[model samples]
Target: MISENKIYFYPIWLRIWHGINAMGILILIVTGINMQFSNPKFGLVNFELAVNLHNISGILVTINYLLFFFGNILTSNKRYYRLKRKGLFKRLQLQVDYYTSGMFKNQQPPFPLSEKRKFNPMQKVSYLTVMYLFVPGLVITGLALLFPETIIENVYSVSGIFLTAILHASLGFLVSIFLIIHLYVASIGKNPLNNFKSIINGYHDIHGH
Candidate 1:
């Protein structure tokens, strides 16, 4: 199958959600850092302000995530996240090879973007794990911290809030790192900025597949 160079990849609703989620994540990371390393002279945000902003951003992100969750279920976009079990390991290896060696040596991607597949093997797995597992875990921990009464005071002896905070911070850190990798990967392709623009324009410039 063949088509034009441009493909409408991100729909308007998806784009809006993506934008809001991105902003919320950025806010969370910044405020999280400020809160973690509280210092009036050097902190990027006031401790009180940071706590308020982090809570608010966390709530917004949670709501946005729910929307994204339902949107995928209600729309055809879920197809892109679906996994094909056959040759999954081999496909992941090839995609990893392409990223580590092939791309720099002018080799085509093992899994090029297409009307049917928005993600490569690695992307699918990473996205699935992050969105489904890490994200929900983060949201649950965040909500627990936001409302401590809902959780028991201790977990098998350790303070519940302490454990919850540690888990929340750990998940937040991993998600932040994922955002960094996501940006770097998005910056690849013929024109680096084209990938970034595609989200805004809703049309990705596909290299012939």
Candidate 2:
């Protein structure tokens, strides 16, 4: 006795890439933590093991990112991340209001899912920033750190490798924060696990789409 609509958004390739990218990012986070904080108090993996796992995860993430980059370029999925400049702020504000206040009051969502609109304004901005800006930054900085010899010897009076390591770690922290927020937001759909199931099955349970 259910009549909810469904839409197929996640293609097989995208789903595969997502699975690998997620696993790689998680492994990188754990291994990065071990390397960054080697204290026996909270650290689980040893430094050497952490370094190895971190490097491997970084490589996997980099490769997966390239797949995502080209996949967007070669597929129709890129439209979801495109920002429509017209009414951008208004749309963003409306979605923000829904998240912050409206949803709490049991109000309907301002921007519901549709065939043409895969994401709201806020999601488009965050996804674009994360996938394009932050992921690339992380990949480049990670590679520089992985091969210290490729790094510049000095910048001003400070070590270039030191700067790269700091930037890389900062990017990792930002990505970690984004991941946490992403997980929490994913649960805000039809049910706690609705979006999670969609990501796995390639079809989102929508309504009136």
Candidate 2: misplaced stretches above 4 Å?
A: 1-4, 40-42, 207-209
For model 1, residues 132-186, the per-residue Cα lDDT tens digits are: 9989999999999999998779889999899999999999999999999999888
Give the runs in model 1 whose Cα sits over 4 Å from its true position: 1-4
Alpha-carbon shift of residue 97 in model 1 (angstroms) = 0.8
Please provide TM-scores, in order, for all candidate models, with all chains considered together.
0.94, 0.93
- The TM-score of candidate 2 is 0.93
What Cα-based lDDT does every candidate model obtain?
0.89, 0.86
Error of 2 at 147 (Å): 1.2
lDDT of the structure predicted as candidate 2: 0.86
Error of 1 at 31 (Å): 0.4
lDDT tens digits by residue: candidate 2, 60-136: 99998988899789988787778879999999999999999998998888888876788878888999889889899
